[model samples]
Target: MRKFWSKFKREDGQVMIIFAFAMVVLIGFAALVIDVGTVQVAKRRMQTAAEAAALAGAQDLPKTAEAISAANTVAKLNGGSLIRTTVKAPYQGNSNQIEVICTINVQYSFARILGFTDTDVSGRAVAQKNPQWAGEALPFLNLDDDYLANPKIVAWEKTAPGDFESLWPDDYNVYFGGKFDDHSKTYFTVDFADGITVTKGTVATVKQEIGYIYGQKKPVYIFSLSSAVIKSGKYNNIKNKDVVPLEDLVLLQVTFDSFDEQDKNLFLTTTKVFDINKGEYPTDYLTSPGGTSATIVE
Candidate 1:
């Protein structure tokens, strides 16, 4: 019995057993760290996908079908599997908001030792399409005299200089005719229904077809209304001779009557009421429908 007891107290194999246990613990900790990091990466990827999809959808608000298509396309492009999406447009009375959720399956690199094959990660985002003051209206000055109700021949020929932006007519005009006496603040930008062809790129436009052109009368619900202190465009050096063909005029839209080359004036019929809200591009407008721009508010 004494001999057996002495043998039992021997340290043989004890160290190997302890070392094996320690190695197993250390490996477990290392594996856990790797798996956690991989999952975090997957979560970030999912978040990116969600945000991209939401923004894409928000741009096409009010149009349900178009918004859905845009969101799906962006999700696939960003490598996220879209789980679901909800959109709230102005018509739906949610202030035009959109939400996107995406997910991803992250395969565990080291956690497989623990029988954990993979984990699912997800992310979500929301966006909104807010109403903005449209700057894209025809070049009409706000008059307190209540003259819009009367069809007036607003002449820009002799009273106004052919203020050309060095000949590259901007898609919109922002010309300033001197100080606040400024009988009229020249601001024009709009998406007219027809009778005008707009080339976003610079096109050699004839002066006759541009600046002083006329067309049939149309109802302009959204007219331009700007304040006294807005950013002004420079038309200093351009002269009448400079208004020759080949000179570009990126005019937004101007169609009031048939091309009566004889009379170069805008005869417009208008309404007095408007939905006053936020203006686009740091605006102070009384009437400029395109004042608002697209942005994420969620």
Candidate 2:
């Protein structure tokens, strides 16, 4: 028994056993580190790819299949595969939102020695569409009986001679106001039968040339003329050179008379012209305190 005890207590080869145990621990720890790091990197890549794809998809959501294609393309570019994609439209508006899921399968090199295979990396992203006028009210023009009561009488000329005699009666007061500022070159001409009495009031008309200079797609003017105002008017041959480039031009003629108080419809006629190079105008006119019109006369 003493001999057996002596042999058992011997320190020979004890260090070798300890070294083998430590090597096993170190190898296990290294395998864990390798597997965990690989998964983290793959996760990051999946997240970045998903986000970009989702944003691109949201732009065309609720309209076309282009969005799904875009998302898949982005995911593939980032070394990930798109698992699924979905898009939903707003309940009461034109906006839409999208969501995407992506996955990557990564295999560990050194960790495989420890019975580890491949790890799954996944990420999700969401996005939405935005409108042009999301939170603001649009502007419009307003006309009522009060507008015509203070009508400004500008000269009226016939495009061709003998178009017709003046329709306004002379008893209606015809007030010839001074010419608009040089900026307002389009003059208004009034033709009325004899004995018409136009009371002293402000007559308003939109300046013709001013609209052109402003470079607005749809240009309109509002003016008023007061009573008992007249000045010597000379006819000047105005050339079309003063015309400014515009997408659209419109003229609204409103006449107010003694019966204007009872008349609800005061608009006479509206003239509209379109220029292709000027740019496309909104299909619908903006409405403000004034009013909004769906269609403009062409």
Candidate 3:
């Protein structure tokens, strides 16, 4: 009986108890790693969705409803079911700024053992519209400063008689890549290698501008060009130029009103010109607040 009591008091099973406790700790550490990894992935997904939603929303800045709608659409498209989205315009007292916040939930794997079903993750992005951009190329130029006179307008015309230009096949082959049967009416833009100045009512300018449209396969912004940069061996100087809008001396953004072929040569509509730095606004005419873009301010 004494031997039996001694055996019972012995530390023979202590290792098993220690091992059990250690296993609990080990399982906890594994769970921690898994939960942390899952949360990290969730955070990344949320961040991506947030950025996409923010960009989409910023495209329609100052229009709260439209911005929210676009944000939601992009968030879902990015595979993140948003828990919330906030669109704030005039962010930080800057009328050109827009902000978007997105939130999502992450389901737990081994974390469920710790009584956690899911964790919430959130990401925020801020976008701003700037009035200036450098290096990006423009395929179209405004005939006049009508866009500046009324920056709210989304459609405009030269209001002068000219031949209807076809944009498909030829222009697409030259400037825009991947030719499809686009029957869009083509308008003339500043074809000058230097965007600083222009000669009014110059047929040579029109022809040169048309040549620009046909010269490059794709119009892209070149942000690396220095002020002294030479293109085609010609120095691009924007120091002082008459007839060029003070705002457009650096760059221009022009979008045609439609892809449909128009036989008419002259028309007057809202200004279709915007800054390349500012993203393309909706063509639906949502009352543009003037010159906007998507930039992360925060």
Candidate 4:
């Protein structure tokens, strides 16, 4: 028994066991540090790539296909492959909004020894054009004035007055000038020289033929000449009673067209009167009125 105890105390091979246990702990800690560092670096790179891709996409939102292509290019250049890209336009009356999202896949290299082969990283970005950027400049004139005349009453006619060829030779001119005018205001008006007795208090209907060169064609209506009145004022009394008072008639319909960025045109048709009393005459018919005052009678 004494000899067995001495042999056991000799500590043969104890150091090897301790050394093996220490090595295992160190290796595990080293693996954690290295793998975690690698993942963090890859994640940062992916995030950057995604941000660049999303911004590139948004800049081309007006051209949806081009935007997607741009995003993918940006992702690839950043050492990441684009996994997904999505672009959404304005919806639900939010006309000024856009959304873009980009995702990328980042593969891991040194961390694979520990079984982490790859990591998925993603990012998103949104952008919108400032509303102020949409406003466009256009030349406009009140149709109520003679400047709209073939020989602009105010401006010299660059050409002969009655020469139909020299008349304001544009579709837009015919559009706005078709309406009637009083003083500086313009109103939709039609003349019925057919001896139609449009009673002052009675409802009267008038029709005007407005022709368009694009899209759709339709006739607009002006209702209830009940508000129509006769105005008599003296500028220099014309020798004959034949000169009609400016207030005697009311123009009530207006038409116009708007062009978008792509040069696509949209037509607008509107009514001219808000309300009319049984015997009340329309006081003014020359000035442009608010849309609220007119109903879309077409």
Best by TM-score: 1
lDDT of 4 by residue, 1-298 (tens): 9988777766555777788888767766776777667667766776666566655554554456665676677767774444565555441233333454555555655555557677665555554433111101011111122211221111111112221111111211122334452322222322322211211110111112122221123222222112322122221122211222223322223334432223222233443433322333244322232111111111
Spell out the clash pairs found in candidate 4. Answer: 185-286, 185-287, 186-286, 188-251, 227-282, 229-248, 230-248, 231-248
Worst 10 residues of 4 by lDDT: 132-141
TM-score for each prediction?
0.55, 0.41, 0.49, 0.37
Model 3, stretches more than 4 Å misplaced? 1-12, 90-93, 132-188, 194-292
Q: Residue 55 in candidate 4 has what lDDT?
A: 57
Q: Sort by TM-score, best first.
A: 1, 3, 2, 4
Better of 3 and 4 by lDDT: 3
State each model's CA lDDT, in order.
0.47, 0.39, 0.46, 0.36
Better of 1 and 4 by TM-score: 1
Tens digits of per-residue lDDT for model 3 on 123-200?
Answer: 777776544332233323333333444432221123233311111121211222223512121222223333334322
- lDDT, candidate 2, equals 0.39
Q: Residue by residue across 60-82, what tens digits does model 1's lDDT show?
A: 76566787688778877885443
What C-alpha lDDT, on a 0 to 100 scale, does residue 193 get in candidate 2? 15
Q: Which stretches of candidate 4 lie over 4 Å from their true place?
A: 1-12, 79-113, 126-131, 134-298
- Better model by TM-score: candidate 2 vs candidate 3: 3
Using lDDT, give the best candidate's number. Answer: 1
Question: Positional deviation of 256 in candidate 3, in angstroms?
Answer: 19
Candidate 2 lDDT over residue span 1-298, tens digit each: 9988777767546777888889878888887787788788878877777777766665555554676776677667765443333333331363455566677678887777778788777777766654221111101112111223333322222212321112222211211224543432222222211211222212222222223222223323222111111111111222221221121121233322211222211222223322223442223222111122111011
